[model samples]
Target: MDFFNDHKKLFSSALAFFLCLTLVICILPALDNQRVIQPLPNAKHLTAQETRGKLIYIREGCVACHTQQVRNIDMDQVFGSRPSLSADYALNKRMSFLQNTATLMGSERTGPDLTNIGARQPSKEWQFTHLYNPRAVVPASIMPSFKWMFIEKEQLGPNDIEVSVPDEFKKGVKGKIVASQDAKDLVAYLLSLKQVELPSNIPVREFLYKSEKKEAANSGKGGNLPDGAALYTANCVACHQASGEGLPGAFPPLKGSSVVLGDDLELYITIIMKGYNARVPEYGVMPPVGTTANFKPEEVAAIMNHERTSWGNNAKEVTAEEVKAIMDKIK
Candidate 1:
């Protein structure tokens, strides 16, 4: 009481000094902890093109709707193979020192996570179409168009790299959609956003616990028969939908489709392994979803079976061996 009354300024100064000390003690250790992190084994520095693309990504405010992170908890595992670690952003931190900004690890997730987008959706054609008009490719998407990044050219010179845009998305433009250098750079950056494989000790958590449990329960009948329905739900449900009815004019419906019920299993396998470019004018081209998703032969077989069985379409179940044989023959 005496100190407060007689030495008010001195007391205030001491309080301020302690508060600052506390902050330093708390913050300094955290900063030091970040500095000690090492990049993952597969993590690499961005190429010049990718760096320029990263700049474009920032300039376009992509970080506002999309996140480049996969968290350890919650629903993040659906976006990536594993939970993200400090090492994942080590390169970003190093670059930030020279660039005067930390990282664009976004806060919102209105769009899907980009941490593993390269591995999940590597199709350049798909990326270009999505950028031109998100709704054209994904009918229900709320993402705004980035058509300005592309320009319509009546003819392509020998030196020009052609960009494939579906006619429906072209908006009556009477020429090929040529991606500007900025668009090319942005795609390059997006393609560079693959998640690095972490060490065995820090393994990716199994997000498909239900599938694993089902497999375990059915192990007695067969050696872990892949849950086709579960696999389809995890992977194919997004594009084809839960009802197996794809978005009209955007994605082809898998329900009661000749392809899903087709006797030519090899064709289906090939389509899954290699992507389908606009085979039909009315629908958007299907990207190499299986390839990007890293679906194993067994998993692919399971997915095929699920698609055939569900939506009132009955077809013979495909085997892992059959899928493998088809994959090997094609490759």
Candidate 2:
């Protein structure tokens, strides 16, 4: 009772108690975690360009809409091959003495998780185009255009990198769109966000709460074919619109393309696996989606059938066996 009456003594005691609690409950646990968790062996540090890009990423508040984390759930499986572990973020270093490091594991997911975006979409051309105008690549995207990151040049410099933007999304600019140093740095950082493979000795964690419907589809149970429409939506729908009409002068249309309707299965399979880059300055280089996603024979067949039959293009549907044979030879 006397001690409570002494205001200074009481305040000091309270402060001491709070510090003790913080030490036991927060600091101790964090220190223990630091000791136990180690970065993955294959994880690489960010390059100079990538570090600059990361600062730009923070400056632009990209973490507001996009997250770098992949939670341990079936829904998050699309973002990464496996559930995220503490080791995935162990290699992250502080930006500087004044600025502390952030995990960038954002709370909201207005856009897709970028935990494995590097492996998923590695094409620099596509990244530049998408950044300049999201609607140019994804017609239904709600993302705001980062047009300021690009420069409109009447004539390109010798070392200038050009971005092929669709006329409709150009906002009436006649000049060629070229990526700025900031844009290049930002894309470099984005491209470095890949999930490294875990060591063989450690047991891989499984994504929990997988729905029976998804399980059945994945296992191809009951003689059912893989869902072509879903596969296309996941992989192809971003660049090629839902109507199969891609942006002109940016991405080639697949509505009535000879490649889709042609009888050349070998050529089609090769393009999907290895990707096509010869159409540069006209269309952005296509990323190796099939290879990145690790598409199975059945999955490839399903996608081929979907593209061939839809958009009023009635080409011959491919079989899993045919696709597998081609894949084997190509590989």
Candidate 3:
């Protein structure tokens, strides 16, 4: 009893010492060691306009609802070409010790991921309209309208950068909705969110779930066809939608599209080989679909064949030889 009483404080000190030693031995090294930072193969530093836009993006809390990550999981299939790497955000850094520093890889995804949004939707006009009134472009969108970033002008001057608000969206407003510099900057930032050519080391590997596996199986890839449906799902479904009826006023529908049903295979091939910027002031841009997805001639042929046959349209099926010829000619 006397020994216990005498050594009680010593025992408590020893226990505390061991706990602290455990932390030092186990936790400190993990916390202190910095992960190797490498730039992506095609990663570029932000331009001045993009930098300003990024600042605005941070200020507006756009990250609250949207995520900038494309996790390497089955659920993130529609996010980007490959899963996000730390190099993607390595260019983002603090200006000073006092200024705010943030990594915009948000926690939740109330809205769709914006990691590769620039590649998916590159329309400046659409971005402006969507920002001014999300419901104007997307009737079912739950996103709050950022109308405050715009002003109602009596009429757009020749020098003015106009926001193309459709007739249905302009319910009672007499003047035109013109985007302010802030809105433009914000859109600029959003457009800069595209992932560039990923480093060769980090290649995307497909992970098919049970339902997706069934869908792949039912897509009829058994014969000479190159799994066109699966290809479409991986590369085209996000923008064009599963129904082939794309988002109205944003992505054009392929269901009845003349381009998809046209007899001119060369034109179709050209569009796929070289990206299309509609520049119609409303419709979103289509990135070079085939090139972006790294699709080969056979894959292109398969995709074209599927597009021609499906969705109630009857058109001639494309062959790999024809696609290869077109691709070679274009090159």
TM-score per candidate: 0.74, 0.89, 0.72
User: How does candidate 2 score on lDDT?
Assistant: 0.87
Cα displacement (Å) at residue 97, model 2: 2.4
Candidate ranking (lDDT, best to worst):
2, 1, 3
Each model's RMSD to truth, in Å? 5.1, 3.0, 5.4
Worst lDDT window (10 residues) for model 1?
214-223
TM-score winner, 2 or 3: 2
**Which has the greatest TM-score?**
2
Candidate 2 structure quality by residue, lDDT tens digits, 1-331: 9999999999999999999999999999988998999999999989999999999999999999999989989999899999899999998877888887558888899999999998877778778989998878876789998999999999999878899788777777978999999999999999999999999998899999997765224322213458888888878877777889987878788899999999999999988888888556778888788997789988888888889989999977778888899999999
Candidate 1 TM-score, true structure as reference:
0.74
Question: What overall lDDT, based on C-alpha atoms, would model 3 receive against the true structure?
Answer: 0.76
Candidate 3: residue 274 Cα off by (Å): 2.3
Candidate 3 Cα errors over 4 Å, as ranges? 1-35, 136-139, 153-160, 164-166, 175-177, 201-255, 277-287
Q: Residue by residue across 256-280, what tens digits does model 1's lDDT show?
A: 9998899998889877877787566
Model 2 pairs whose backbones collide: none
